[model samples]
Target: MSDNITSNNPSLEDVIAEAVRSGLALVHTSLPGVVVSYDSSTQLAMVQPIVRFRRRSTSTGSLETYIPPPIPNVPVVWPAAAGGALTLGMVPGDQGQLMWAERSTDEWRKTGAADCDPRDTRRHDYGDAVFVPGGRGADDPLPADAYHATATVLYGATDVLLGDSTATDKVALEPDVQGQLDALAAVFNAWIVVPNDGGGALKAALGVLTAGGWPTITGATKVKAK
Candidate 1:
C-alpha cells in the first residue's frame, strides 16, 4: 500500500498536504446527495464550481482570489467577496507557524492554526549517543544477530526499518520515548519496530510507556498513556 506520508521531499509533502487541506466539510450543501447542516459558529464553505479566478502573489506568499469573482453558490456558505481565493500554498499564522487557510475578501484568511505534517517514512533519526550495553568499549558496536529474545521483548521491537519508502508508517516519538527506543535498539537486536500508521501508533506506544509496564496493544485501548 502507498504510504500517505512516505516522503521527506518538501515539494511532494506540500502536494499531499494541499490535497488533505482541500477537504471542506460537506455541511449545508444544497447539492444533491450531499445532505449536511451548518452551524452558525462554523465558517467553512464549499468552493462554488465554475468561478473564474486569477492567482496572485503576496509579499509573503501567493493565493488565488475570487473577490472580484464574487458570487454565491448558496446562501449559507458564501464565498468571501467574489469568491475568496484558496491559498496557493500553506500560510503562516499569527505566531509565524505554518498554517492552512481559506480565501476571504481577496485575502487568504486562516480560520484556524496550521502546521506541517512532520511524518515521513523515508527518514531516520540516529540519536547522538549509541546504545551498546555491555560492550567491550564505546566503539565496539553490537552485532545485528547478537540481540536475544529477552532483549526484543523488553523493547517491543521485532523488525528493522531501513529508512526508505519500504519503512512505511514510521513513528515520530516524543523526546523521552525516542531516547528509550534508541537505547533499546542497541540491545533489541534490530532497528526498532514502528507502527504502520501515523501519530496513532506513537500515541499507543506512549500509552504502553505510561502504563508502567510492557503491554500488548491488541486494539485502541492503549491510547491513553501520558
Candidate 2:
C-alpha cells in the first residue's frame, strides 16, 4: 500500500476558499463579544466590539495623577484618526522615553531627577540607554536585538458607524459585519505577526477591502452621542 494519502478529488479553488474560510472562523472563535460584518457589494469586512469609557478624576492637594479609563473591551479595529497615518517600525526597547517626543515639542527640556547635570545631557539620549533590567554603564548602547516591530491598522468609516450604535441595528448589521470581520482577521493572521515588518501585510489587507467596492472611509472625527 502507498504511504501517501490522496483525497478522491479536490479543486484548487475549493482548497483556497476553505483556507480563507477556516482562517476567518478561527479568529471569530478566539475573540468573543465582537461583531463582524462583510459587504459583498464592496468586498469589505468590518470588525468591532462594544466599548465604554467612564470619566474618572481624583484630587490631591497640589499634584494630580490622571489615568485614562481602561478599555473594557478591545476594539475590533484601531481608529486611524486617533493616531495619524499609523506606521509600523522597529525601535529600541529602551526607547520608551523617546516615544513621547511626538506628543510634546519641548519634551527634552522637561527636567527630572534623571536629568541633573549639564554634562550629563549626553546620557539622556536614547542611544545611551540599556534595555536590560540593569547594565554596567550609561555609554553601553543596548543591543539592537532588543528592538521590536509594531503593528498598526487605520480605522475606517465602518468602525465609526458601529461604535455609534448598540441598538437592534447592530443585530441587523451582524451578518454583513461578521463577514468583514472574518475577512480582516483572515488577512491579519496571514500577514500580521511577530518580528515586526507588517506594513506589507496591512496594505494587502486594506487592499482586499478597497478592491471589494466598499465605500471610501472618511470623516473619522470623534462624535459624542446626544
Candidate 3:
C-alpha cells in the first residue's frame, strides 16, 4: 500500500547502504555543505561531529591554518607643481590642513594648488567639504590646463578660492559659490554684529545650507555648530 520499502522502519540493508553512500559522499564535498546542510530521510536524525581527516599531507589544509595575501597600497590624487610656486596644494604630509579666504589682506589669493602656507600668511581650515580638481592619481592624469566651476574650502565655509586665478579670468568664484561665501561671512559676522547665541547661529547656517549655498560634508564626518 505504501511506496516505501520500509514504511514503519528502515531495514538493516537500507541502513548499511545509506552509511556507505554517506561515507563515499564525504570524500568529495566542501566543508560548508557537510556541516551546514545534512538531512537524513530517517525519522531518527543523528548529527555527526566534524572530524579533521586528511587523505593527503599538506602544509596548510585547514581554514584556521590558512594565510591570506597581503593588502596593496591604495593610491591618491596629489597636487604637484605646475609651472608656478606652491599654493593651495597638498604635499607629502599635509592631511588635515587647508587654506581659504578670511577677508584678511594675507588670507588667500589664488597662486598654485601645490602652494602651502603661502607668503608666511596662515589661512584658516574650514571643517566643511571642499571640491578641487587635480588630486587625480596615476590612472587619472590632470589635463594640461583644467578648471573647476566651484571651489570652496571644506568641512565649513570659512573661506573660498578658485584654486588658481588662471582657472578662469575671474577675480571671484562662481555666483552660487560667492553667495555661500557671503552667507558664511553673514553667519560669521553675525557673531561680531549680533550676539553669539543659538538663534543667530542657526539663522545664518541654515539660511545658506537650505539654499544650496553651503559645501557638503560627505562620508562619516558630521557638521556641528562652531
Distance from true location, Cα of 226 in model 3, Å? 31
What are the clashing pairs of model 1? 28-36, 64-85, 66-83, 67-82, 69-82, 70-82, 207-225
Stretches > 4 Å off in candidate 3: 1-176, 192-226
Which candidate do you rate higher for TM-score, 1 or 2? 2
Model 2, span 1-226: residue lDDT tens: 2211124464666567656644543231111112234332332223222232222123321222332222121211222464342211211221211011112222233453444434442322222211111122356664554444674433332333333443122222445656666776777777755456657667866787768864323322432121
lDDT of 1 by residue, 14-86 (tens): 6666455444321112111111222233432222222233333455344555532212221232223544321
Q: Compute the lDDT of residue 170 as modeled in candidate 2.
A: 23
Every candidate's CA RMSD: 27.4, 32.0, 27.1
The lDDT of model 2 is 0.34
TM-score of 3: 0.14
Give the number of the best model, judged by TM-score: 2
Q: Candidate 2 at 108: error in angstroms?
A: 74
TM-score of 2: 0.18
Displacement of residue 77 (Cα, Å) in model 1 is: 14
Q: What does candidate 1 score on TM? A: 0.13
Candidate 3 lDDT tens digits, 8-94: 476777667656644553332212101112122211111112233323225442223222121111112134445643233233322
Task: Estimate TM-scores for all models.
Answer: 0.13, 0.18, 0.14
